[model samples]
Target: MISMDEFIEFVRGGPLGPIKKWGTKWSLWPVHLVTACCGAELAHAFACGYDGERIGALNYGIARQTNLIIVEGAITRKMAKVLRITWEQMPDPKFVIVMGACGLQGGIFWNGYHMVKPSDVVPVDFFIPGCPPTPEALLRGIRQLQFKIETGEAKTSATFPEVPLEAGRKPRVLPKSPKKISKAPAVIVNAPKEVDWEFGQKLVEEIKAKVEAKSVTITGKNRIAVKVESDYIPRAAMRLREMGFDHVKNVNVIDVPNEDKFIVEYHFSSYSVKELMPVIVNVFADIPRENPRVKSLASMFPSADYMEREMHDFFGVIFEGNPWMGRKFLLAPDAPEFPLRKDFKLEEEVYVR
Candidate 1:
């Protein structure tokens, strides 16, 4: 039996070759596979302002019916699998156009642990380079693909002339890298310094009166650090809840492997109280890195539910009462376990000279 590539070549070599190519070129329906922030640019391209349909490419829903895949922005390790699966479901004579610098390389997240290049997972026909490429650039990429289809050859829309260097001029020298990577950087999760604030002073007094805090310090403007033992977090959370901290703004876990501890902080704020809107109280505690366990504050602040699960996924910290404990939340099933932990290193890349 002939393969899909062979069948396509036969069709192209037959009497209806021009007709097939023309039809395919003009009828490029792209399946929506938005993986990241670059989706914003893709939306602008198809929206009323750009009207990408003018070029004969319509953004469709299903993978089987579409002939093109525009991979938008950063394809995470998790999204790469989905990208491959989507490509497999597309019909024969399918093409791929990877958009943004993230799709080509890693863009801003070049050294990120979760980032995966789209090109590594799928056969990309064209790559549009930008943090997020402009709508015009995306449309131009579509045009380039269409040209490749009809003419069976790739052509650039622009050309540049080569310039010779002057006789006494030397080649440009790149400056040395300024980043000083430390093997063991001192990780100070909470070393509180005093800040002057009248409201902060009053707030600290109120917290001291209500909750049994290990230490209360005004970290910055509108920011307060309330330290407590791991066992007392739930109690502290309960007190904060009563004090009008209705929501958990953020749940953060800092892995201090050098110190053999993990700092868990739940930033709390209130939507009900207008005065508390800008105030962020960080309720933090340090737990042994080897046996990281903390009482879940989800019961007190229901908004901490997903945040706790995410922290569980990244740092392998057990939030005792959270139902999603021991289960994956934000990270993929096959992704490296406890990836955000300082001890968990990403796979190193080697560039060929």
Candidate 2:
């Protein structure tokens, strides 16, 4: 749309030209869009040993000042929105570097319903693949980005091509689920493992006697899984509390869509009891997916309060006694409903006044 002189000036980066390229390449400040375990690896790159200041890519908190975005680790549905918003805020001549196996293909969260690829969210210049990529490797990615900035060598698969859209199709259509969805492997957390922990036997026996659970098995060295009925979660929590398992370390909800159930688990561990401090007891229960309701253990284990609200928001799992139920907690008010569920489909919600 511009004249020949204008086009030449644009290609030459206005007046500064090579000086601009040189400045941009060296002074590539990064704004982090990090999540999960890969955040630690990103921190190590900026830590005492590696020295990120020397690399000339010091992390900035705000988006406008930074030219680079280091998207570290798994990008969820919610995080994808944040990534786009942050990327849009940057001034000009921006670059994206996704650093982790999770950012590319989900890694440990391999078939997760909520997982969103970093490349799908933004134009990624480099992808450093590892469970968590090393500091040296991340440094190399930054250097490559710098190289691309200065030299304009657009490597194959490094950046996205601006594809012309088809006439009838809308961008960012959600993928259709397979006609027949298979049930996930039932034995994830409670898979019985025979470890040489003699103490586990007595501990399991004690827990079994106290809590009327369907199955009580040692999953790992110091890990015991106690699965009770949905109605019996409160009773089981109280019984575990009486037996020195004082607090809830973690509360999780696993969606088993094909089975028409949701597995709710509370990882109970002891702080006051020194002997039991090393051990972790995972008490879990299954709930009907259609009518997901269970007794909340927030009163019994205060730590379960926030997680219960989070689960409610993500999967629409109602914890009957939790006061914070029937409201948004972790997710935005406009976010897709029960997004973590396996059969989640994107649908437009309309309101009539």
Kindly give the number of clashing pairs for every candidate: 0, 0
- Scored by lDDT, the top model is 1
lDDT of 2 by residue, 220-272 (tens): 99999988898998999899888888999999999987678899999999999
Query: Model 1, range 202-260, lDDT digits (tens) per residue?
Result: 99999999888888888888989999989998888889988898999999998888789
Residues forming the 10-long window of minimal summed lDDT in candidate 2: 344-353
What local lDDT score does residue 177 receive in model 1, on the 0 to 100 scale? 51
Tell me how many residue pairs clash in candidate 2: 0
Best-fitting candidate, scored by TM-score: 1
lDDT on C-alpha atoms for all candidate structures: 0.87, 0.86
- Candidate 2, superposed: residue stretches over 4 Å from native: 1-64, 67-77, 80-201, 214-221, 256-259, 332-334, 345-353
- TM-score against truth, every candidate: 0.76, 0.57
